[model samples]
Target chain A: GQQVMQIPQYQHVQEGEDFTTYCNSSTTLSNIQWYKQRPGGHPVFLIQLVKSGEVKKQKRLTFQFGEAKKNSSLHITATQTTDVGTYFCVSSHQAGTALIFGKGTTLSVSS
Target chain B: GAGVSQSPSNKVTEKGKDVELRCDPISGHTALYWYRQSLGQGLEFLIYFQGNSAPDKSGLPSDRFSAERTGGSVSTLTIQRTQQEDSAVYLCASSPPANEQYFGPGTRLTVT
Candidate 1:
């Protein structure tokens, strides 16, 4: 079975600080997707990376896929209070079945 | 267009009882998924439906859990003889092939 593991299960930061979360998969992945889940809310898709060694950005957020396609990272610069939530990385293998999600990194930004 | 919608936003049932959760996917979407989220936990995949093909139920925890999609539009997940551990928020999401997914508010189930 394939599994995705995320680092820093929980994080707490003051406003204006930076935050980063990493996701690693046991096997190579065809694609990786990131999502955010607010408190008491459903998970929302953020971005997806399909190519190896790919990078994408959204404002202050940056996402990267490893050259081997076995890991990924999401980094936020100058975090704001609104950034508080859980960040998850999901990956799908060759079979194109359901996405396997990582344990997720819970970010807490304090004002 | 409307996003995924789920029925019985909240359900409280006794142990050993049966419960059914419903999910209505967005129109024209070809893929629908069911997931479970425990308190403060990540999403757990349960089943996936693509078009009219058979569903992928590998993520189901036990034989008591089963799901079906009718006409590729609506889906229902049934749990029989539920136990305390079955309490969780069941989420439904729909997506077009090779596109981002949209999620529903989810149904919170509590087994007492």
Candidate 2:
């Protein structure tokens, strides 16, 4: 069974601070996707990376995939109160059969 | 152009009872998935269905859990003889052509 492990299970930061969460897998992944779940809300699709060593930016959020395609990271700079939620990194099997979700990093921002 | 939708936003049942949750994936989407999220936990994959392919139920925790997709549109997840540990938010998601995944609001099930 393949498992995606995320670091810093929980993160709390002051407004305007930075936050980052890392994800790793024991086996290589064909691609990886990121999702965000607001408090008491359903998970929403954020972004996806398919190429090796790919880097993408969406506003203040930055996503990177490892060259080996076994790890990924999400970094948020100058976080805002609206950034309070859990970020999850998910990967699918080589055949795209099942999706493996990471435990997620819950981020809390206080103004 | 609507997103996925789930029925019975919340449900309460007693132990040893049976419960069914429904999911309506976006129109024309061929890939549907079922996931469970316990309190303060991440999404746990339960099952998957592709266009006309046999479902993959490898993530099912026990024989008590079962799901079905009819006509390749709607899906229903049934849990028989539910236990208190079964209380959790059952989420449904669908991806078009098997790529990015979009999730539904989810059904919050509580077993007493």
Candidate 3:
């Protein structure tokens, strides 16, 4: 079975600070996707990375995929209160199968 | 006409009772998934449905858990003799041709 592990289970940062979360998989993945779940909300798809050594940016957030296709990271710059939530990374091997999700990193942005 | 939708946004049942959760995926989506999220925890995969083919049930935690998709549209997750540990938010998501999934509001189940 494949397993995805995330680092820094929890993080608390002041507004305008930066934050990052790392994810590693036990086996190589075809692609990795990032999701955000707000308090009492469902997980929302954020982005996905497929190619090795790939990088994508969305506004103040940046995502990277490892060259080995077994790791990924999400970094947010100048975090705001709206950024508070749990960030999860999911990977799937066989197409259309259930995605294995990491434990996720909880971010708390304080004013 | 939009994203995924779930029924019974919240449910509270006694121990040993059975409960059913429903999920309605977006129109024309070919893939649907069921996931559970415990309090302060990440999403836990439960099952996946792709078209009329057999569903991938490998993620189910126990025999008491089961799910079915009717006509490749809506899905229902049933828990038999539910225990207190069964309390969690059941989330449903659907994907188009691509891998990016869109999630529903989820059904919050509380077994006491």
Tell me the whole-model lDDT of each prediction, alpha carbons only. 0.92, 0.93, 0.91
Candidate 2 regions exceeding 4 Å error are: none
The per-model DockQ list reads 0.67, 0.76, 0.74
Off by over 4 Å in 3: none
Candidate 2 root-mean-square deviation in Å: 1.0
lDDT of 1 by residue, A1-111 (tens): 366999999999999999999999878988999999999898899999999999999999999999999999999999999999999998888645777778899999888
Docking class of 1: medium
lDDT of 3 at A66: 97
Which TM-score values does chain B get in all models?
Answer: 0.97, 0.98, 0.96
Candidate 1 residues B1-112, lDDT tens each? 7888999999999999999999999999988999999999988989988887778788999999999998889999999999999999999999887567889999999999
Q: List model 2 lDDT by residue over A1-111, tens digit each.
A: 367999999999999999999999888888999999998998898999999999999999999999999999999999999999999998875755777789999999999
Tell me the native contact fraction for each prediction. 0.64, 0.82, 0.82
- Model 2 residue A103 lDDT score: 92
Model 3 over residues A1-111: C-alpha lDDT tens digits? 366999999999999999999999767888999999888787889999999999999999999999999899999999999999999999887666667788899999999
Clashing residue pairs found in predicted model 1: none
